[model samples]
Target: MGPDQALYVVATPIGNLADMVPRAVEVLQCADLVAAEDTRHSQRLFSHFDIDTPLVAYHDHSDDQRTARIIERLEAGETVALISDAGTPLISDPGYRLVREARNRGIRVVPVPGACAFVAALSAAGLPSDRFTFEGFLPAKSGARARTLEQLAGEERTMVFYEAPHRVADTLDAMAEAFGEHREAVIARELTKAFETFHMAPLAELAAWVRADSNQQRGEIVLMVRGAERKAGATLDDESQRVMKLLMAELPPKRAAAVAAEITGVNKKVLYNWGLEQK
Candidate 1:
């Protein structure tokens, strides 16, 4: 029997078309159908590469009907290729539902990896790439975004995030506030395209730079922040301990530790140990 039908998750270029892998092109050209995040936006890519495969829209709003249709095609031994408007399918894009359903139905899923904005940016950001977290995009609202940043303030793994042009400055300002002014960060903009730029500095300085230059606010942005330094013989601060005690009064020790970690960005283990010592 022929090899089992599969869904190919292909990655395209972030900006520069030259980065499109030959294998990805071949998969797109050969697939029976192409599931794209945005059919209109992907048209340019199809036109550029002369890929005439039938395109179907699949995005965040795509209902189960769409996914079911794709799975049905896969089950019938038809090959389908999934592509996001740019980069890899489902990095911060749609296709998760389709992929999951395909797997549950015993359909093989193959990844034709290529360009990814976060990976590309992290590779050259000069931060600790050994351990990193890709926190896709920040919340649109300033207050919510700040709260999210606060939760990750003590993250030891390098944090990567995507920000729209208009909110880039505000996001940087929030980062500066949540992670101290001296936290090192790298702002990579327009990556893999003409006018691509990378600016590295302390969080406060980076925020100031973006604020002063309107140009910096434009383009696709990947922001990388250095992980919190692990100090030797580190102990919980008095403020954190005080908060933990107050929480413990109203909640169980474990619950208090968790909440304290979220509010103060302190390590949960440390708080838990402190809580145990108190009891």
Candidate 2:
């Protein structure tokens, strides 16, 4: 029997239907009512799982009255399952209002966790995961997007963003301009579907590649950008990095890198790679 007087925040599959959890299917099947972002779209999922539970539309545009109605049912000890069009609800999808109000009214809130797109992309992006930030979607317009990226130029955490298929190329261009062209990034597209891809390259190359191929511009996209390099040398100390930069202005790249390495006890190859990135 489904737990009553509680909201089960259910996670739906983003692309591949196989990712759906057995518990989520059980909860929905036994729920007294299923609150969905799109009732029609959710109908397909229900039909597939043979979940004949009633569905009520609840989304960003859901009015306070609509929320009041749902809360009323929950208070009456009815089981309500919340599911978005895809993935976990409220991760850039709707249902936050209902969940928020449910908690305020002392209704139980349970998470039936499963697939989440960003979490999956970050796991294999090859970027630092220890300390990362989820920035969600950036501004859609060029000027606004530039300003937003400019503000995050110094972010030390790996940045994650979702972008529409058509605007991805322009967004990558803006990111390359804001961050250095050499900054590394990954494009995860069509996630679990047949055309799934995870292409990682320097920002400039990635941007050019996406621009050149119309195929890269299509499908769901997750963009992961490496954080800004710590000014201190990867192999050397801060003073060594400063000295190497100063010497390169006057000496040849090879000579300056060699001199810096000899004086600082740092690897010459590492110093040389730094010089190449600067150029």
User: lDDT by residue for model 1 over 1-279, one digit each (tens)?
Assistant: 222358999999999999999989898888999999989999999999999999999999998898899898898989999999899888998989998998898889999999999999999999999999999999999878976786687677999999999999889889998888999999999999999999999999999999999999998899999988774544788999889989999976667989999999999878866665566
Candidate 2 least-lDDT 10 residues: 228-237
What candidate 2 gets wrong by more than 4 Å, as runs, is: 232-279
For residue 252, model 1's alpha carbon misses the true position, in angstroms, by 16
Global local distance difference test of model 1: 0.90
lDDT of 2 by residue, 1-279 (tens): 655558999999989989999999999999999999999999888888899999999999988999999899999889999999999999989988999999999899999999999999999889999999999899988988986886677677899999999999999999998888999999999988999999999999999999999999998899999998766646567898799889988975557889998888888868865765565
RMSD of each: 5.2, 8.2
| Cα displacement (Å) at residue 66, model 1 | 0.9
Per-candidate local distance difference test: 0.90, 0.90
Worst 10 residues of 1 by lDDT: 1-10
